[model samples]
Target: MKKAKITAYVDAALFDEIDALAARRRVPKTQIIEAALASFLSPDSAEQSEAAIVRRLDRLTRSLERLERDQEITTEALALFVRFWLTTTPPLPDDTYLAAKAKGKERYGGFVETLARRLGKGTTLMKELPLDLPGSTDPR
Candidate 1:
């Protein structure tokens, strides 16, 4: 492989950490940088990009926390709306009936059937997920 040198500025603490990592791993900074770049560029090199991964994970954690807070606020608003609507509006068709008859029942039914089929596999996804209580031991 060809080698080239490039200079760039970085935060002191972060550069120190990077240098420490290189020293501990007994690898050069260039090797670490190259491997990182390769992982970022490669389709199947996830294990090699620890720094990028930590950065991405930190970003995702922050975004997810914001989203979770937003979700809680949205859920509170929705619950309040539901309470107000239940008291004020004429509630004939409830959500369950409305959902069943929304012409989307077929889509939901298909999803249910797909789950049943996957559960039939036994040793696949269902093995890793929580099982229904008492299990499906009935022969009926």
Candidate 2:
């Protein structure tokens, strides 16, 4: 195929960039300029770019939704635990207060250890929850 020659003016910095890129790739500067012009003038370039951006946005939206759902689950679990603890636990008498505090500390340490082990094993309350649980929006 025969090629046509045309003169065009570009920014000095852009010219330098094209020169550098051509040198690095061991190709003629005209080749790089031709490829860049072809891409810019392609009919479907804008649509292809927009489609790629939309795909990324869709992925981000799904990730954000999952984060929101996880946050809701965590908040609900904490609220339920607090309500149950407040209603069921009786106030300790002054006579047994010190003993109860010591026992509570020991039990808390055991609970922490058990929690660590479960986490290390990748076990989670979310995994144990039924898919059909009330108020759950999880599709899995």
Top candidate (lDDT)? 2
C-alpha positional error of residue 12 in candidate 1 after TM-score superposition, expressed in Å? 1.6
Q: Candidate 2: where are CA atoms >4 Å away?
A: 1-3, 8-33, 131-140
Q: List the residue pairs that clash in candidate 2.
A: none
Residues 1-140, model 1: lDDT tens digits: 77788888989997898899999999998888778778788966655477789899999999898678667756886899999988996645665677656656788889888979877876443233234426644221
lDDT, candidate 2, 1-140, per-residue tens: 79999899999999999999999999999999999999999979999999999999999999999889888988999999999999999999999999999999999999999999999999877776655488866565
Question: What TM-score should be assigned to candidate 2?
Answer: 0.69
Instruction: In model 1, state the lDDT of residue 12.
Output: 95
Off by over 4 Å in 1: 45-140
Highest TM-score, which number? Answer: 2
